[model samples]
Target: MTSSDLWDAETAERYDESSAFMFAPDVLDPAVDFLADLAGDGAALELAIGTGRVAIPLAARGVAVIGIELSQPMADQLRRKRSDIPVVVGDMASTAVPGTFSLVYLVWNGLGNLRTQSEQVACFRNAARHLAPGGRFVIELWVPGIRRFPPGQEAVPFHVGAHHVGFDTYDMTTQQGTSHHYRRHPDGSVTYGASNFRYVWPAECDLMAQLAGLELERRVADWTGEPFTTDSESHVSVWRRPEPPSRPLEAPAGA
Candidate 1:
């Protein structure tokens, strides 16, 4: 029930360590490349940009990447790595940094971080407000509905490490799920923990963007621009902001 539990300083510090390599670019570089191409000649705004995982590389590529994070610890952590990229310590829903950006990105299902329908909508609105003319908002989120087709189906196995494994289970009604991580430590100790939440679908996300005045430009099964099909479990959605108005508005007849 607490947004701080998922985000904030303590969680931010432990996030990268616990979920290290979860968003491996080797499996995602093609998507990043596609995003980079859309990022021509302009700065980028990254939401929930924990620990600078993607922003660092993006900044290194000569792209100006600014990050907005709720956790000061995460922003501080990113600062420790590199001071080149600017990070604003605040929530993505309400935080406003001056000036517009050419590209804005939220990865790793970061949209789910809001944990509420209204909050998610606010995120879309805020993203639109920050975009420059002809800017784009790029997101990577799960496609949902794949986990439950026949009904009452739960429990999907996730292999983390050779010895460390996990199980993710979902509630058919609530659409919530728990990811349990079981790690066998070298000292004969086993670590067990769980995180739960609802999953949002790609179609719902597209609608969210459309309501925010952004248009879906492309949606790919992966970062490589692969066509999305029924078999694809996840997606990379790209949305472009409405282009500038064609001409200046004429004034009504003077009083």
Candidate 2:
């Protein structure tokens, strides 16, 4: 069984509509630009690529892009948009795909979906396994929001909107959390949904990269390359595989 929560047909179908704001040019262009620059004529693999939000635009920019998604329904949704982009339905932590990539990325806090430290570490290893020498693995993840909790508090409200209300409840000991959402329909009926995740610290991610034989290259607060500070709520981190050393030239015969 997959460790991650599966997005069923209903979720997949409504995903684009529910997440419309994320598709705005202002919010999306910077991410595409950041990733495209890193891809730089090389292919990229997106872990948990959902509905081609970033992948579609990134591919339109001439970057060869493929995806690994845990949810077949989500993959089907993506296929409806672009048949040319291939997607494999499997667990991102251990799924294997053909060909090495110059860039492998997991965005939108996808790493947290693993829900276990071991799985998350294996995910790093899997990314490293798919990366060519000097290739980079990038992840956009939220820093744990425990700081927002007051003493004895376990829940934090992340969004309080007219049509949608969302909050997260945390278990400090396990570093696990669940984001709960309530969406009101036009008819005034409400729907509820929740997803579980294991929150990870940036330092823990650094160690995971190290264990995967990748070196930390950069860490920014966002796709725009802002400085990462303790107060930052999220981070976009990049780790690179080391390039092979150049061979020394041999001396001329009888030099």
Candidate 3:
């Protein structure tokens, strides 16, 4: 299993084109709108800001945004569209980007890019470090349905389309999954790519955030603030850094 840096030059180059649907106005508007509202004129730092799919539009909405990306090629792709927003090239799990932000967000399954529990915990810590008092850290990820991987069956198909196909292979013991993608081209060619990630339960995520000094603020099924339900396939969770520690009470006579 690879780390967040798994998006290599080849994967990065094709990323925008391959996942173009995610950028459509209908699909992207809600996400950008949600984050922009949370930012409320304050700065936002995006972890694993791949190709600026969300950051670009969010910045356009008047939120000053910065990004941290491990894949230089992916960051390079975003550089073409906007350069004003700074992007730190480093691991999202431990790398420290400059400045405190009102909001830090990890979206599009990026949090899962960390393939181990320790690494995932580090990512939560990193987010807490970037947040100011009363700031928020948001994450969007799918709830693990890995229990469906009964017996020897390991692969589960999630997407099948005219041009693209995708599946996830679960390792029950390790709680790791390898997401595989394949796209077909007009010239009768196909390209396959895969990345490793650790699937996380919502409760586990909350505990990790707590360990990093964040508290769950809200959770929704999508960017529109819909209530999270057991039937929900994915969730957008918001966690907030509490205010700085208050002064302890002193006894009347200095007891």
Candidate 4:
């Protein structure tokens, strides 16, 4: 993971407030429900957990949840909410926590934060490493929106609101993109923020999972389980680690 991608103290401090819409019941509840159902009496691990936005509610539902976050400030913000959830501070691609889990998840396009194909692949392997046999690894990611780009256009606007304007600029050759945000304050001052990520295709993610010894289980347009059609803008995909092969029965008393 790139250290430059880490959310700093300022970003962490304003994270929840800046992205408040994501915490609404309409957006958050379905995600918690989906993950809790997958966990099903087993522990769940979150990659790039970031401020406990999902982990807090998911944990409230009686599912054991642990987290790995690359940003210490983000982890600190999460700790402020609830002290019980264990959050390891390190890169999600290679961080190792003790014990295995029934479910491992990376939500809100966190995989893109890795910024490199190899790092993203390593993240899949890391998720597989922390899963118990037959455990599931899940990711929620945006489908690259290059189709909206006309000739010679490298940027597309995603949000144009009363107080904020946001756009993403893509580099087709490198599969990298940067999301730029301009927020207008009550005083008419504007603040600018940007984050960089490498966009990945759904097929590429499946190949990474395969390389990590996991099998594709399902893919949906969102946490609500909408069927993933060609026009879907984002996806929530699941891949499961195969259970260990059973040993052959031994002859009774070595007869």
Candidate 5:
């Protein structure tokens, strides 16, 4: 894999600053509050918990949070911020973090990092493995913006700013995409970075959750419980592992 394929140390160092939009309280609080309410008195496990962005604050709200992160550098940033949250260094796709949790969440399109359907399905199974009965697995994902694509065009610009340019190039046949970003510096130099993802639709995600023995409980357009619709650009979906069936009480013989 190329250095860019992995979120290595250098990339981790700038993840927070580069993705500041994700850290804004307006954007973050609703997500945290939604997960916190679901967690209740039970613990929550976060997959690909980069820099403890959500986990740290959720912990501050008294929800026990554990994280599994593949990038040590990203986890280190989390540590530098706060040491209270337990973080395990491993791939979120299959890493076995000890103890079952009431909630397992992967936010901000982190599942896209898997880059393949099987890996993403495994991630769902892994989330199921770590969940207590009736517990939830939540994911925040963007709906693929196909309408923006022109005929015969495979690329679409998503962000254009005074100092940065961002776009996505897609391969429709394979459902793969590469999101590219270029940051212009004061010295007139440019830095380019790209991230790979395999976009999965909401229906496809429900099938993956079914394969993991979980069921889609609810899917909203956003964190505030808005109804999902065709016009929605993103969604926050919740899947639940069904609680075990209760055994029927037997009456006394010949009662």
Candidate 6:
């Protein structure tokens, strides 16, 4: 589906109800903590901060968070949070927001939404543009399942509920995956939600950061800082923006 079809207001509202609970404390808490700690007493920027899932919690922890969102509905949803956070409705690839941040993050496979390698690289550039010197950019994305799905493979399915099921299957050679999300309503109505998109591996993402002049700081399998290995299914990588060109901001004017 097109970007417009996937990210409009109506669709965004339904997102959390559809998918948020799929991940639990194990995933949510560590991810939030990682972002909060990296923020380091400075402001944070969250790209595609859908419904304030992480941003709200981080802000409640007394961190100042600004969100960059593409969908108004998504930003509106975030505004409903009991905790306060600033949000800008704009494109992650092009739109620039004011203020430099110590931490910029894209969570929950948000990087996959960029689709193309160039657009992905543009996201890194945009993050760099908004980052303070020594600021960090954190990304959470899936480890491509290509090695698991050799030629002729079609699907990898898993059961979720007694009635609901989720399947994330990919075509290895084509670089595409169809994530089938399903549910059964109390009224006995069954509905299906699916998104098909391209997938990127961790190494390519490193190159994207390098091309954007950001240096990779760390890579882990999850928010808890599990060491990334060949068996890792998802990755959390951190990148640092280089220090500014001149003397430090805190330096004396005459020096």
Clash count per candidate: 1, 0, 0, 0, 0, 0
Give candidate 3 regions above 4 Å deviation: 150-152, 245-255
Give lDDT for model 4.
0.95
The C-alpha TM-scores of every prediction are 0.87, 0.97, 0.93, 0.97, 0.95, 0.88
Candidate 1 per-residue lDDT over residues 71-113, each given as its tens digit: 7788888999998788898888889987899999998778866
Off by over 4 Å in 5: 1-4, 186-188
What global local distance difference test value does model 3 have?
A: 0.89
How many angstroms is residue 101 displaced in model 5 relative to the true structure, after the best TM-score fit?
0.6
What tens-digit string does per-residue lDDT give for candidate 4 at 222-248? 999999999999999999999999999
Evaluate residue 69 in candidate 1 and report its C-alpha lDDT on the 0 to 100 scale.
87
Error of 1 at 215 (Å): 0.5
The number of clashing residue pairs in model 4 is 0
Model 6 compared with the native: what TM-score? Answer: 0.88
Model 1 alpha-carbon drift over 4 Å, by segment? 1-4, 7-11, 23-25, 145-153, 248-255
Query: 1-255, model 2: which lDDT tens digit per residue?
Result: 567999999999999999887899888999999999999989999999999999999999999999999999999999999999999999999999999999999999999999999999999999999999999999999998888888888688888988899899988899889999999989999999999999999999999999999999999999989999989999999999999999999999999
Pairs that collide in candidate 4 are: none
Error of 4 at 96 (Å): 0.5
- Clashes (candidate 3): 0
Residue 142, model 2, lDDT: 90
lDDT of each: 0.80, 0.95, 0.89, 0.95, 0.91, 0.81
Q: In angstroms, how far off is 240's CA in candidate 6?
A: 0.8
Off by over 4 Å in 6: 1-5, 171-174, 245-255
Per-residue C-alpha lDDT of model 6 across residues 1-255, encoded as one tens digit per residue: 223224677777776776657447776888888988999899999998888888877888889988888888888877876436778878787777889999999998888777666777888999988999899999999887666655676776644785578788876675667778788877898888777666898888889899888999999998888899989999999999988778656877789
Cand. 1 Cα-lDDT? 0.80
